[model samples]
Target: MKKVLVLAEARDGQLRNVSLEALAAASTLADGGEVTAAVFGSNAAELAATLGQHGASTVYTADHSALAQYTPDAYTQALVQLIELANPDAVVLGHTAIGRDVAPRVAARLGYGLVSDVTSLEAGEVFVRPIYAGKAIQQRKFVDGKTFVTIRPNNIAIGAADASKTATVVPVELEIKDLRSIVKEVVRKTSGKVDLSEAKVIISGGRGVKSAEGFNTLNELADVLGAAVGASRGACDADYCDYSMQIGQTGKVVTPDLYIACGISGAIQHLAGMSSSKVIVAINKDPEAPIFQVADYGIVGDLFEVVPLLTAEFKKVLV
Candidate 1:
C-alpha cells in the first residue's frame, strides 16, 4: 500500500478543477492506502471539504502572507515542509503553472525522482508521458524510494465526490523568508471566464482569421457554446492575437471535451497541444489539411461564413 500527498491549487477562492484532478491522481497512487492534499493561501480551510469529498483523508493548509499569491520561494518552502511532515510514499500535483515551477524545486530539494506531464498511470508506479512534442510516448517508473509526479490537466478522470467523507484540516505555518522577488499583484489578460486548460470546449483560430478583428467571430461562436478561445502560433506570430491564446507545443496543452479549429492549417506543433481533446472539429478551405486526419468532423469553407452559422445554430440548441 502506498501513501500519497498532493499539492492542490486554487484561484480566486474557488478550487481549480485541476486540484480535484490532482486529488483523484493522488488517490490512484495511494492504491487504497491513504491520500492527503495540501492547499496554500487563505482559502485552505474553506476548500478542505471539497478535497475530502474527492478522497483526501487529510488536508494540509498553509496560510501565510507570502503564500497569498504564488511566489516560488513561499510555495516551495511550504511544500517541502509538508512532505517532510507527512513522510508520504509518493507525491502528486497538477501539471499546471504552479506545479511546473514548484514540483522540480521540491523534488530537487528532497532528492526524489520526479516524473512530469504524466497522462496515464498503470500498475501504480508506472507512468505514461508524452515526449517529442506529443509525437511519441514515454513510459517510466521509479523502482524504489519516494515517487513524485505531475499529472496533465484534463488528462485524468476525477472520481465523483462523496458527501459522507470528511477530511481533517491541519493548518501549518512555514518559516518563509528571504525574498528575492515578491508578487505584489497580478494582472491578467485572458479573454474568457473559462480557463483554457480546463475548458470543456474551445474555438481556435489561425492566420486565416486575417486579423485580430477576425477573432471576434470565433469569440461569438465560443460565447454561444461557452467555450474558450485559442490561437495557433501563426496567428500569434502575425500579431493577430496575444501569445496567451496560443495553443501549440510552444504554448498551452489542452484536452477539452470539444476543440473547434478555424482557419488553422494544422502544423505539427499546433496539433501537439490539442490532439488529446475528446472531439476535434476542423474548419479550413483546404480539404487536404493534416488536421482533417485527426478531426472527428471537418468543414471546408470560409470560417467567417461558417462560424457565424455555427454560432446562430448553437444559440438555438445550447443557449
Candidate 2:
C-alpha cells in the first residue's frame, strides 16, 4: 500500500477544483493506502471538512499570515517541511500555475523523479502525458524511492463526496523566512465568475474573431452555457482579447467537458491545450480547418451568424 500526499490548493479563500481533482488522483495512486491532503494558507483549516468528504483520511492545514498569498520560496519551504513530516510514498499536485512552479522545486530538493501534466495513470507508477503539442502521448514511470506527479484538471474524475465521512485535521506551524518576493495584491481582468481552467464548458475564439467587439458574442454564448471564455494565441496577438484568456501551448492548458471553438483555425499550439476536452465543437467557415479533425461536432459556417443562433438556442434550453 502506497501512502499518498496531496497538495490541496486554495485561492481567494476558496478551494480550487483542481485541488480536489488532485486528491482524487491521489486516491487512485494510493490503491487502498492512506491518502493525506495538505492545504496551506491563512484560515485554511476551515477547508478540512470538504477535503474529508472527497476521500482524504487526514487533512493537514498550515494557517499563517505569511502563507496567506503564494510566494515560491514560502510555499516551497512549507511543502518541503510537510513532506518531511508525512514521509509519503508519493506526492500529488494539480498541474495548475502554483503546482507547476512548486512541484519541480520540491522534487529537485528531495532528489525525486517528477512528472508534470499527467493526464492518466496506469498500473504501477506509470503516467501518461501529452507531447509535441499533444500530437502524441508518452508513457513514463518513476523508479525512484519517492514519486511526485502533477495531474491536469478535468482529466481525472472528481470522487463523489461521502458526507458521513470526516477527516482528522492536523494543524501545523512552520517558520517562513527569507522571502524574496511577496504578492501584496492580485489584479484580475475578469469578474472572477469562473476560473477558466476549472470551468466545465468553454467557448474560445481565434484570429477569425476580427476585433475586441467580436468577443462580446462569444461571451454572450458563454454566459448562456455557463462557460468560461478563452482565446487562441492568434486572438491575443491580434489584441482582440487579453493574454489571461489565451489557451494554447504557450498559455494555460485546459480540459473542459465541452469546448466550443468559434472562428478558431485550430493551430497546433491551441489544440495542444484543449484537445483533451471531452466534447469539442468547432464552428468556422473553412471546412478544411484543422479543428474539424479533432472536433466531435463540426459546423462549417460564419461564426457571426452561427454563434448568435447557438447562444439563443442554449438560452432557451437552459432557461
Candidate 3:
C-alpha cells in the first residue's frame, strides 16, 4: 500500500489546527493507503488520537526532553528515520515556522523534490504553489522519487468528526546527536491576542489609521467582533506598529473567514497575504483604494467615523 506521511505540530500537548488540516489533505491523497502522522514531543500519543479523528490511521511519536523545544537537528533526525521506515509516497506538513525549517532539510537529506507553501494539492504528478508573493500560481511535478509538500494553512478546510476511527500510536526510537546549533532560549511574544495565522477573523489597520493610536480603534472593533488584529506593510513601514503585526509579501500570510481592511491602500504585496480571506470588507475614505477592488463590501468613508460605528454596531450584535 502506498502510505502518506503527515508531520503533525502540537503545543502544550495539544495538536495544532493546521496539523489536523494536513492530516485531512493527506487522507484524501492516501488513495486507500495508510495515512500516518508523526508528532514529536512529550505525551504525543494523545495528539496521535486527535489525528485519527481527522483521518490519520497510524500515528508515530518520539518523546524526549530535547524534542520539547524545537531543535532542528533532533526533529530532522527523527523524521528522517520515520520516513525511511514508513516509506511513504508523499510526506505532507503544515507550512509553519517548524515545517518551513524542517521540510527542506528532510527533502535535502532524502535527495527528493519539495514543494513549499502549497495552497492546494491534488492526486496528480504535479503540485501547486504561489509565486511572486501570490500574484501568480505555478504548478510543478517531480519525476524523481517520493515528493514532499508543505501546505499553507487556512487554504484547506479541516475534517469533521469521524468517531468510528481512532489513530493507533506507534513509538519511535531516537539517537540524540550533538546539534551544531543549540537553542539558548525562546522568548515568546508578550501579546495575549490569538495568533494571526490561526485566527478565524482578522481586522487589519493600515496607513489610513494614520497613527499608532489609530490601531486603538481597530482594536476596539476587533474586540467587539472577537477577532485578531493585523497591520499592513504600509502601516508598519510608517512605524505605526511593530513588524510582528505586519501582513504582506514580506510578512505573515493570513486567510480568515472575515478580513477587514481599515485604511489600507491594498498593495499587491498586502493583497498577497489576505486575498484568500472568505469575506473581505474594506473601509477607506478613498473609493479608489486598491483594497476596495477586492473587497466583498466597500465603505468609502473616513475610518475614524466608520470604525466607531462598526464597533458600536458589532458590540450590540455580539452582546
lDDT of 2 at 162: 96
Model 1 stretches with alpha carbons more than 4 Å out? none
Please write out the lDDT profile of model 3 over residues 29-80, one tens digit for every residue.
Answer: 6767889989888888877767888888888888877788887898888889
Q: Candidate 2: RMSD over Cα atoms?
A: 1.1
Candidate 2 structure quality by residue, lDDT tens digits, 181-268: 9889978887465689999999999988899999999999888888899999999999998899999899889999999999999888
Candidate 3 Cα lDDT to native: 0.85
Clashing residue pairs for model 1? none
Residue 301 CA displacement from its true place in model 3, Å: 1.3
**Better lDDT candidate (2, 3):** 2
Model 2 accuracy (lDDT, Cα) = 0.91
Model 2 CA deviation exceeding 4 Å by range: none
Per-candidate TM equals 0.98, 0.97, 0.94
lDDT of 1 by residue, 6-121 (tens): 88888889898988888888877888899999998887899999999999989999988999999888888888899989999988988988899999998999998899999988
Clash count per candidate: 0, 0, 0
Give the 10-residue window scoring lowest on summed lDDT in candidate 3. Answer: 186-195
CA deviation > 4 Å runs, candidate 3: 123-126
